[model samples]
Target: MRTKPVSDEKSQRKRFLSGNGFVPFILRRLLTSVLLVFGVTFISFSITQLVPGDPVAANLGQSAYSDPKIVAAFKVQFGLDKPVPVQYVKYVSKLLHGDLGISLSSKRPVLDDLKEYFPATLEIALVAVFLALVVGLLLGIISAVTRDRLPDQIIRVFSLTGVSMPAFWTALTAFYLFFFVLGWAPGTGRLAPGADPPPTVTGLYTVDSLIAGDFSTFKQAVAYLLLPAIVLAIYAIGVLTRFTRASMLEILGNDYVRAARAKGLPEITVIRRHVLRPALLSIITVAGVAFSSLLAGSVLVENVFSWPGLGQYAYRAAVGLDLPGIMGVSMVVATVYITMNLIVDILYRVIDPQMRDAS
Candidate 1:
């Protein structure tokens, strides 16, 4: 039996991405995501309602908390006087109109707060994902190539430690070791003390600095970001390394790979053209998941590093019992998670003919 030619595979991928089914596939995913986001709103709102503190009391002073008129007025102002269901309905209604509600602690709209901090998180997460892909793929390929050997065993142990360690614990350890012991790492925040931030083109200091040709700010931004990004990437790196190893191990045994090797092709060429290409589908999926997880769950890392990202914003909201802010963060996280999965699905249809045919 012969495999389809390379040209045929390319054509199939092209058709899958540009063909009639692509629109419907995207539509289905969008619909599903919208529904999931709606459900998330309900759950987030309900969960915030159960937080063990009074938002009014948290925002107001102890003396103000005893003032019934001020408390009643505060509740009314925030729509906290309404039933949970009614509040949820109103929240969703306002959400559809692009209102994320005012944060009780900050007295600012939650959307504004997210806008202020989200870029920091996005910058760090992107850097971490890039690092994870590079290091994980390299380590994985090495481990698979050196299967059952000392190198593979060492990598396996490293991967296990990376995945098993709690992110906050790793973050704290890294912080102390680098900042206090080694004195090589920049300590916390997006820049050094009194450093003038770059002009806000994208709200990401690294990007904005480059755009403005300010290499000084860019260097400081990267220095501060490095340790935290690495800490954030540890788990993703572990997961990706293990996953890539498994995928490569499976594909390495395929007939095409064996045939390519038998054809007197260079070892690197055979691995690249045959083994790695087939394994990319799995790698892409896991990478998307890892990046999304980094975005949603980097709260402890952000807190440890004092990185003013969405995670830190969420932490503050939760601590202050800022219902609107908590719900806003939840919606953003849930939406991001669902969106990443949808993107992975689209890549599947684009890369894999079997998935396209099934669709």
Candidate 2:
């Protein structure tokens, strides 16, 4: 009786310990990300300050200098007169409180500007990422399985073209060929000019349209989204296809794959059951990294399409020397990249039991 009770207690303790281990792992990842965000913000702020130009004068406009008193007051207001270290500290402190400061050019709060634009960018990026994953994975698998056949050759050519083309050039050429020449899609804007803008529930036009049960508006929104999404998908497809092909090739050569073949398993079953899962692990990793680039790369695509998104905002900000806007966009991009990488790290354990055990 005593031995039985002791064994039960020991088993419960082991289970408890095993379950609690993930708590620390999650907490550590979150803590590390917070530190990283601060570090990136500091570096970004420092670099912008060090860049050649007077941010204050630029912010105040050239005409503000007509009055010497106004120029002095403007510098004092923005703290350009303060030591660089002091300014950095103040900027970081404000950032931690969700105040990104005001854009020098637009004279609007950075957070407010981001709030206005980030949703459209995110909607486009999400659609593009989804398409990239589905198409890239399928093409990669087909190409790898088909080996040196026509399908493989075609996919390779597509991937190479995607990789080699610059995004702006691709966007411009795509716009010209598809919109200007073919006239299959709208030339610019998120919707047809006369179409009623849907109510903003989630700030995503597609989702909002669906919620309103307006199929016509939803269809229009989706159509407007396609060109930019396809442009974004071009680069992602190339990257993911290469990774998936490499991973699939390695998995195909694994012992388990050979054993499955030896066991006379159906070819499809062996490929799907023993090969694809392991191959997908690497592909997932690549997809996560690819997602980080989508937001940044959307700049040219957004500009070409006249989509009101963060990319367009960032472009205008850079051209106009909107320091606050630039900083806000950079911070958002950095945060997104860091978050994606962290999610990927966590997913590694989930996808690979070996990784979970090792952790």
- The prediction achieving the highest TM-score against the true structure is 2
> Pairing residues by index, what is the TM-score of model 1?
0.90
TM-score of each: 0.90, 0.91
TM-score of 2: 0.91
Q: Against the true structure, candidate 1 has what lDDT?
A: 0.89
lDDT of 1 by residue, 77-143 (tens): 9999999889988989999999999999899998989888889998898899899999999999999
Off by over 4 Å in 1: 1-20
Q: Model 1 misses residue 102 by how many Å?
A: 0.4
How many pairs of residues in model 2 come into backbone collision? 0
Candidate 2 runs further than 4 Å off: 1-20
Model 2 CA lDDT for position 21 = 56
RMSD of each: 6.0, 4.1
**Where does the lowest 10-residue lDDT sum fall in candidate 2?**
1-10
